[model samples]
Target: MIRKELLSKCKEALTTRQSELIKQVQDHFGMKYEFAKETSGELSNYDNHPADTGTELFEREKDLALNEHAEKELEEINEALHAIEEGTYGICKICGADIPNERLVAVPTTDTCVEHAKNETFNRGRPIEEEVFSPNINPDEVTDEEQVGYDAEDAWQEVSRYGTSETPSDFYGDKEHYNDMFPNSDENVGSVEDLENFLAADIHGKFIGVAPNHDKHEE
Candidate 1:
C-alpha cells in the first residue's frame, strides 16, 4: 500500500516540477523568438537561403528540441498527478505491482516499476552488424595454435594499411616508414605460400607460368 505521507510528497514534487517545466517552455520560446528576430532581420525565412542562416537555423532547431523535451516531461508530470488523485500513483501500469518506495521517490513521474519500465539499452541488445559480420577475434585471447586463418582482426589490418592513428614511436622496434606502424607490418597478405606471391595460372588452368619479378620474390 502507498503511504499517505509519500503520496503527499510526490504530489508536491510533481506540482513544483510542473510549474518549472511550464516556465522553461515559455522561456525557451521567448528566447527563440528574440534570437530569430535579431538574426533574421526580415519578416520571413522564405527570402533567406538555407545555407545563409545556418547558425540561426541550428539554434532554432536546438531550442525546439529542448522545448519538446520539457513539454513531454510536463505531460508525464500531469499524468502522474492525475494518477495520484485516482489513488493509483505508486502501482506499475504493466504488472499492477506496487512500485518500490525508493524507485517512486527517485522518479515520481514514472508509471511502471524498474523491471517493467521501457529500457532501450536492454531491449536493443547487441549491434545488428555482429550477426552477419566476420567473427571478431582478440589476439590476446588466442594462441598461435588456436588462431583462425583470417578473422576480423585480419580484416582491420587490411583496412588499416590505408591509414591509422598509430605513429612510429608507438611501435616497440624501429619503424622508419608510416606503412610499418601497423601490427605485423612485415607479414604477407592474400597468399599462403611464398610461391603463390609470384606464380599464377590462367583462368582456364591450362597455362601455368612464373610471373615477372619472380626472382626478387624468390630472394
Candidate 2:
C-alpha cells in the first residue's frame, strides 16, 4: 500500500502536470489555427514562385507535427489523472511493482517502472518500405548485365556525363586537361561492347576509329 503522504504528493504533481498539459494543448491549437489562417491566403496564388510554395508547405507540415505531439502528450496526461482516481497512479502497470518516488516525481504521467520503461523507447524495427524497395546497391559490385538495364550506378554515370561541379583541379590524380577530370576517363569507353567503344561510323557510312589509349592507325 502507498503511504498517504506520498499519495498526496503524487496527486498534487499529477494535478499540476494535467493543468500544464491542458495549457500547452490550448497554445498549440491556437498556433495551428493561426498558421492555417496565414497559409490559406497563400494557397490561391498562381503567380507565386515554386520556392515560395515549397516554404509554405514546409511550415504547414511543421505545424501539423507540433500539434500532433502536443495532442499525444495531453492524452497521456489525462490517462495519468484517470489512474490517480482508480488508486493505481504510482504502481507500475507492466511489472506490478511500486514505482520509485523519484521516478514518479520525474515523470508523473508514466505508469511503468524503469525496467519496463526501457522497452517503450524508440522502435528498432526497419520500415516496411525497405522490404519492398531495396536501398542502393554498391556501384563496384554491379554486374555487366545489371549495367545494361536501369541500375543505380548506371543512373549515376548517366547523370555524371552531363557534367558536375568538380573541375580538373579538384580531381584526385594527375589530370592534364578537363577531359581527364572525369573518373576512369582514359578507359571509360561509353559503350558496353569493345567494338562500339573504339569505333563509330560517320554520316557517309565510313567507319571512324576513336579509341583514346590505343593507336587508331595500327595495321
Candidate 3:
C-alpha cells in the first residue's frame, strides 16, 4: 500500500512528464510538416546526381524516424498518467512487486522494474525475415563437389573482379600481363570444367600440348 503523500508525489511527477512529452510531440509534428514542405519544394530528376538525391532521402527518413519516436514516447507518458489515476502507477507490470521509488523517479513511464525489463533492452528472438532469406552457407562445411554451383572460390573471384591489393609486380610466377597476375593463372583458373585446366597457347606461336591428368590416370 502506497502512502497518500508518496502517491501524490508520483502523480505530480507523472503529470509534469506527460505535459513535457505533449509539448515534444507537438514540436516533432511541426518539424515533420516543415520538412515535408521543404522536400516537396526541392527538384529531383535524372539530371541531378544520384548521391544528391540519396542524401535528401536519408535526411527525410531521419526526420520521420525522430517524429515517430517522439510520438511513441508521448503515448508511454500518457499511459503512465492513466496508470497513476488507476492507483497502479508504481507497481511493476511483469512481476507483482512495488517498483523502487528511485527507479520510478528516474524513468517515470516504465511499467516494469529493471530486473523484469528484458524488452526494454535486448530483443530476445531472431527476426521473421531470417526464415525467408537464410544466412550464408558456412565456408568450412562446403564440399568439393559444391564448388561448381556456389563456393568460397567463386565468391572470391566475383569480389576480385572489382579489384585487389596485389598487382602484377606482387605475382610469384611469370606474369607477362596484368591479367596473368591473379593466383592460379593456369589450370582451371576461372572455368568449372577439368578440360579447361590445360587449354592454353604460348605467345611464341608454339603448340602448348594438353598434359594428361595424372589423377585420372592413377584412377
Best model per lDDT = 1
Structural similarity to truth (TM-score) of each candidate? 0.52, 0.55, 0.53
- What's the true lDDT of residue 157 in model 3? 57
Clashing residue pairs found in predicted model 2: none
Which scores higher on TM-score, 2 or 3?
2
- Score each candidate by Cα lDDT: 0.78, 0.69, 0.68
- Model 3 score (lDDT): 0.68
Q: Comparing 1 and 3 by TM-score, which wins? A: 3
lDDT of 2 at 195: 61
Positional deviation of residue 90's Cα in model 1 after best superposition, in angstroms: 6.8
For all candidates, what are the clash counts?
0, 0, 0
Tell how far residue 4 is off in model 1, in angstroms.
6.9
Clashes of 2: 0
Expressed as tens digits, the lDDT of each residue in 103-209 for candidate 1 is: 98999999999999987665656688767652445553446436547665667777787889888777898877786679986655545555665756766876576
Cα-based lDDT at residue 199, candidate 2: 57
Please give the range of 10 consecutive residues that has the lowest summed lDDT in model 3: 210-219
Q: What is the C-alpha local distance difference test score of candidate 2?
A: 0.69
